[model samples]
Target: MAFKEGFVWGTATASYQIEGAVHEGGRGESVWDEFCRMKGKITDGDNGDFACDSYHRYSEDVQLMKQIGIKAYRFSISWSRILPNGTGEINMEGVNYYNNLINELIENGIEPYVTLFHWDYPMELQYKGGWLNSESPYWFENYAAICSRLFSDRVKYWVTSNESQCYIGFGYGTGWHAPGLELPINQVVRAWHHNLKGLGLAAKAIRQNAKGEVKVGLVSCGEVGIPASDSEADLQAARNVLFDRERSEDSIDFGFGDLFEPAIKGEYPKSLIPYLPKGWQEDMKDICVPLDYIGINVYIGSIVEACEDKKYRNLKLPVGIGKTSMEWSFKPETLYWVTRFISERYNLPVYITENGMANNDWVSTDGKINDTQREDYMNQYLSALSKSIDDGADVRGYFYWSLLDNFEWAYGYAKRFGLVYVDYSNYSRKLKQSALRYKRIIETNGEILI
Candidate 1:
């Protein structure tokens, strides 16, 4: 079989990355807003002040997705924009903005998959200890309840948060992301627990407040270990490294289980038990709420081999492997292994919520962006994904990492990862050739890849 019938083919974008009018719409300040102000924090001092101007031009964006035959659009809602302070009055303007965007998508025959949080924490909450505060779960629950009450009538697919590892580990543990703070391991663990609790609570709120049935899940990111060879030992080693609990302590290279175990299994891994806060066991009820699916944002993976001492060791890539403009190694099999591993472990349907590569694209002399490398990347990756399905991996869908070239977090706009190119100076959008290829793939329901 090729891809399963009714497989979702879509594109994704986050709020702060695309929505520009940050200061307007009665929007409150987010940690990212403050993070962008810190000197030397952002590359070339770039920020999201006017990212693609999507705030004023969302209609244009929806049309672009329609032109490319995107059936669904996965986007996030800015928390601070909805509740300026993260826990108080509702901002009608913010609600109206999302309403307009969602209505536009529905009018254009595109499904809307909403992510509640994508690392844009409210500045007011950050000052109050953010996720470290015991009340953070309720804060998120309140926000989620409002969203469900308002938009659930039209939006049915919901993701509570995107990549907790990056937000909690990199943002709090390593000081790499917004509200950057290099806290001790124990504090980081505490923040992670709070984040998980928030996810569970948010899921409950969505169910209780949704106008109708909804599919809820969490988006996680981590390494996917590929076996060095097809040997049984190597396959076991790859699986071991992907789920090992020891990797959780490394902050930057944790495994999916560090977050998924607590959220899905309702208890922290035994290795992490010591670092948990007091009364953490009582929080399991909320953390273990049932989920309809698991969302994973994958890009690259490393090779793993079985070691002599009954362990697995990840091998470093030698010189000359294909690399993206962001320097991420090109590994198409990562999509196969990640889906297979997650499906086998959790027994839940999987969706590749984000997968795409950055390319140093520019308007060529012919006035067209011929992103052939990205096109090839998509073909190879999707081929591997089809192989996984043929081997019994229950993958439900794939959403590309982005739809437009917006703010690239700390890397700024230097890296381009969009199917459609955005001229930074004029905010004009031009579809790369890969987009047309994708349109054909979507039109045929991935038959081209098969």
Candidate 2:
């Protein structure tokens, strides 16, 4: 089945990942900027100092989106760029850069979906106890207010935060991402609450101030449980793995559920209740803001089987299964099961806000990027998404993970996940075969999936 009418088709990117002018336009430093300077943090010692140079070349990027025939574009804003100190003092130059980018998208017949925070926490905030501070939620509300008041004229879709599980879990729990600090679970739990509270407050603020029917949500990336077979026991096993009471491991799904349950169900999962900080229960009132939709960033799934005592057990992945450049599992059907599970579980409209595979790509000898693997990956995953929608899941939209190849967090420029390949040598972007096929998919409202 084709996607429903008015279903959005677009591409997504993060400010710190794509916009490279870290020092330009009076922008304050971000944790990523500092994290990159620390020895042995990044894979290739690469940073976003000049990532795709999109800060100065967004017009070309927007033109690329227009040419691709997508109806919307989802991109994030750098907190430090708008508020240099992460709290006080507005940087008009930094503000102007985003304004120009937003206006460019609007002028090109494309709608803009703005994500207020995308893991680029201002360095000033990090120094001020970051999310561990009790006042962090209010600080984030202030930031959200500024963004809503400034850009709501054109951006109707507002994402309060993007993938808190990564920014909080990887940054705080395992110390893999920016501001790399392996804090204890207690501290990590504190940071997690702060993010949800901030997102809820931001949603409330955007609803109050945004012009012309704004939709607000949060973005999360986590585990997807796909049943091993089509039996009832297998389906139950998938659910048990996805939503059961196991609390031993600090998995991505745990973080995603802890952060998501409050917003959707007005409480954290039962397994995680013991870990909540004092007064965390009361804070749910602020964290349970009504969201327009839930955005999930899914890349792969884990196979699960029914176990004794009505439990589920994850089976280890066999060796030599297809993998991406990032070594992530290549299970395109993840889109189907995850979407179906989340929509039915949460009873909310779902959006695949980030979905794409990194490929080993470059400009070929004929001056063409013939990335057929990426094109195939997109096709298979999107077809899986369509299957979920066909099964009565309220899957609303799908935003390809990226529009251009840029700095990929700790891996830096080593992993390419964009439909448009960027020549780091000159910062020139060339569209791959995937981009053209994606354009056709969007133009057909995903009837191509049929």
* Best candidate, lDDT: 1
* Residue 48 C-alpha lDDT in model 2: 93
lDDT per residue (tens digit) for residues 322-414 in model 1: 999999999999999988888988999999999999998988999889999999998899999988988889999999978998899999898
Model 1 reaches what TM-score against the true structure? 0.97
Please identify model 1 stretches exceeding 4 Å from their true place: 248-252, 308-311
Clash list (residue pairs), candidate 1: none
| lDDT to native, each model | 0.90, 0.86
User: Please, what are the lDDT tens digits per residue for candidate 2 over residues 1-450?
Assistant: 467899989889999999999999999999999999999999889999999999988999999988899788999999999998899999999889989998989988898999999999999999988898889999999999889888898888899999888888899888899889888777787888887888888899887887667889888777777899999998987866556535654543354566677887897877766666898888888999988888999886889888786577788988889998888898988888888888888888888899998999977899888888888888889898888888988988889989998899998899999988899999998888899999989888878753
- State the RMSD for candidate 2: 1.6
Q: Which 10 residues in a row give candidate 1 its minimum summed lDDT? A: 245-254
